[model samples]
Target: MNEQVIVTGASGFVGRCIVKALLVRGVGVRLLVRDPARAAALFPARGVELVEIEDLFTASVETLQTALAGGGMLVHAAWYAEPGQYLDSTRNLVCLTGSLHLAEAFVAAGGRRFVGVGSCAEYDPTPGHLGIHTPLRPQTLYGACKASTYQVLEQLLPGAGVEFAWCRPFYLYGEGEDPRRLVAYLHARLAAGLPVDLGSGEQVRDYLDVERAGEMIAEVALGGRCGAFNICSGRGQSVRQIAERVADGYGRRDLLRFGARPDNPQDPPCIIGVLEET
Candidate 1:
């Protein structure tokens, strides 16, 4: 029997892409989802199996072990990411605790590799490229929780003989994204011929297509490397540039209204990631 890769949050935007990439590579996948019907509807891949769990944050160690049986790699992407509420949500603490418990369960279940999805928020909001070795001074509650999880797992997983990798993804734009996100918002407004309320639009961010980001994450899970890896394009582009590009696709650059909205006071001017060579 081939080793099965177990993926949490398999119904999410990025998780769906990861499952597709795994299937394209001829790897079997076991998806741990809260809703079996939803997962089935979202992903109908032949090599995918769905394991239903009521709540990952509260699932028992025994249950997790059983669900993860026969799986060699665990790609943990589940979290409380409810758009506007996630940044400061107290639910981050629950996710932090639960993720740690899941990691322990994976190790106990004889899992070989654990790949966790992190975020650019885990880094300090300095106006430059962030490397894996960049100082981690996360400001938001969400970032703090993710950084704390990575720190603990960095110390714990190696001693347990499990290979671990934390992938910090920068901005992503592509299909199935939340409508409130920047790319989706721009697309919607432009497509509808509504004026796009924008800020200075000069903030530099590293954006990668969601599918490519998912592929990079899957590579991290399947490869032998460990530690933190930035899943990004390693290049910076301004928000205005992205907006203009999207507008070009719709032939509606006139709909974009720069400085129509105020920028977040705490938002950094630039937050690009430095890509590591594979």
Candidate 2:
């Protein structure tokens, strides 16, 4: 707990939560961020070491190693996660390449443990309830790249004497959520007492608060656990169910219009996570 843990993307929504969780546990943290001022305002506390990286996905291995040197643990939560484009973006390739460099740097720095964040999309979507054993059938470029990263690091890190863990989050939502996402959109509409448009609202998913997801990821970093971990709620709720619950908070169920919009044909009917016992 005393050793410094280096966290990339420490200013991101999930990364912010991860850093906060580590800090709450009294762990020293060094943030790899582009904006040190933003990170400073976010943390505003002692024991946070901020190192500015212009672009993590493009940084050289040596540059990364210099920043990572002397760190005992690394939480790699950085990626090209622009809300709408990330799923199909060619930037995923860049991220994949950069992640490899980052892993190499971690190893070069003699880091003891490396924990990386992943996505549920890495699994085959046909399984409504995905377990760690689920076959990887990433349908989108983003998923494919994430699966690729996990597979590569899974083999490479352990062989290099570095403990590795991958935390795959499913349907995380909460503070700092992208406004275009489901929970945020619902809140925006309901708060304004405006009609909220949606699809059939029948797709079931495993949703977890980002804060709790961060806590779980931090636990993996702090403990001796290895392999893939699903950071999810382990319970499936229909989209309609989630919408209604959000509406109830604003006393505006009338504002929800379930069939106002057409559903994405590609969206899976159900995607839930089965927490892996680690």
Candidate 3:
């Protein structure tokens, strides 16, 4: 395999971590981003190349081919993930089409491996441990798009002689996480000594540190792993537990206001992934 890896969404939260992990391994990296200046600032180091594109959704086939050329692996992590609007965003259709185009271009350009980041939402939200074999019944546009990509590419790429893997990540929290996300919101509220409004606090979820998740993603890209893998901690923890943990860290558990906010009726009571050791 070629030592160079091409990564889309290299400036996003999870993408940045994956880039860092690959760089630490002394792998040559080519980053595709809409903003070259921002990616440069974020990853200013040796062995990394930045390729600026106006938008992946509208990027030309030639542009994708150029970025993917001679790379051993292509990690497609870019997608529209705006805090409040992404779940049902129409942009997901654009992502699905664009990502599929990129995958096709990568395979034609001799890329040996293709790894795309999926979401736990792609699985049916029944309360149980989700595995790679779990039936995919995505609930939202975002999940549907991811599941669609996995279904198409899992069959398309390998037939074209390109190794394919889809990584489904559970709740992720760490540096660069959006402030509107659960962990960041809780941490911010607790640190300010303010009451943190929460729901019933009984919804169980699988949370994984973003850094570890990135490492696992990088390993999948560099290794010979194929098919779907869950990037998660495997263990389940309630929303209340996570809030309490953050509050405790801030020395303000008393400030936690469970039941202050109403729970989303669509949210599954429990959604955890079955562990897949790297």
All-Cα superposition RMSD per candidate: 1.1, 0.9, 1.3
On lDDT, the candidate that comes out on top is 2
- Each candidate structure's TM-score, on Cα atoms with residue i matched to residue i, is 0.97, 0.98, 0.97
Clashing pairs in 2: none
The global C-alpha lDDT for each of the candidates, from Candidate 1 onward, is 0.91, 0.93, 0.90
TM-score, cand. 2: 0.98
* 90-200: candidate 2 lDDT, tens digit per residue: 999999999999999899888999999999999999978999999999999999999999999999999999999999999999999999889998999889889998999
Q: Candidate 2 at 111: error in angstroms?
A: 1.2
lDDT of 1 by residue, 11-80 (tens): 8878888888888778899999999999999888788888999999889999999998877899999988
- What range of 10 consecutive residues in model 3 has the weakest lDDT sum? 1-10
Candidate 3 off by > 4 Å: none
Strongest candidate by TM-score: 2
